[model samples]
Target chain A: MENSLITADAVEISEFPHLAQKYSVRGVPKTVINEEYVIEGSGPESMLLSTILEAVEKTGSG
Target chain B: MSFIKDADRPAVKERLRDMRSDVTLSYFTQDVECDFCRETRELLEELSSIEEKIRIEVYDFKTDQEQVRSYRIDKIPATVVSNGGASGIRFYGIPAGYEFSSLLDAILMVSRNESGLSDETRKALQDIKVPVHLQVFTTPT
Candidate 1:
């Protein structure tokens, strides 16, 4: 998974714009799964793999 | 304000019936004000009745701090669409207009326990280790 391009759109610039707001975003390309899991940003395949593994373990979601 | 026309209920319910997981929509709002708040509350209530698995819960925004805290809710007419998981995911402001599509997406995701995201989208979200807050803003059309 080469870093997915989930760029902050214009709303990010116009609505709540700030790098301090970066912490709020937590990380780029964050994808929320079932609203139960959230992946921060691009990482090594292992990182993403673990995130999925952990989310499944935690949520028991199909 | 029943934004969803009566004509549209059949399709929405038909689509919703495909869900295979437990789903609940928790609404937080104050009674005294906000025109959109009342509308949202009614819309969700009606939506809930469309199915048995689709449940609804309403709480006072000003009086229910504990409930609000549980969901980390910070806005009126806020909604937490959870798939029987821990709550906190919030849809701030009224989810009307195009944002309702997102609301429907969230409901389907929760109810199906399936997130059919692209591999690339999944890759992008696969390494988050912190609490990420996502706020999407839109105006009712």
Candidate 2:
């Protein structure tokens, strides 16, 4: 979400080992939302959106 | 040789035609050690040539200290897609396969300077006061 407070980055696991280990990314196509929510696989746009929304809401940050 | 296939040019051009502003991709790489640096640069070059509003600026990761610091790029084959300014959108590898579409989407978002988020999502984001770093990791395959 560029217009919002959320910033997005597509990180290559091989290049950034620290991040990969910090998030425990053992597989490809893992999406770490806000460093709090993890979506391990690919899905529809709605699914990704809802995943972020749910995670943020649960954490009471957004 | 061109990295983008000839068949892909028409559709790629059409998608980038709607860009409202000029988008510059700041790419950082080191020649000696990076595996995907050459390919990533070539891909960005080919993609940028497909649209007038798109531009690519290549930088040496070891020598371009100012650019690396300004963009906060900590890895090789890193690309920062920005339109008006830095939008915090980055790609840490070659945008190949399905990830190519992700780069296109990022370019569109940067050109429009809008997230295209829903009203509900926007409202929720409005409540967030701190910075949120959302990282999506994926392989080229």
Off by over 4 Å in 2: A1-5, A14-22, A34-36, A43-62, B31-33
Give one digit per residue, the lDDT tens place, for model 2 in B44-110.
9999888989989989999999999988787788999887566888898888877898899989888
Clash number for every model? 2, 0
Give the Cα error of residue B49 in candidate 1, in Å: 1.6
Tell me the lDDT of model 1 at B141. 43
Docking class of 1: incorrect
State TM-scores per candidate: 0.65, 0.82
Candidate 2 lDDT for residue B1:
80
Candidate with maximal lDDT = 2
Best candidate (score: TM-score):
2
Q: Which residue pairs in model 2 clash with each other?
A: none
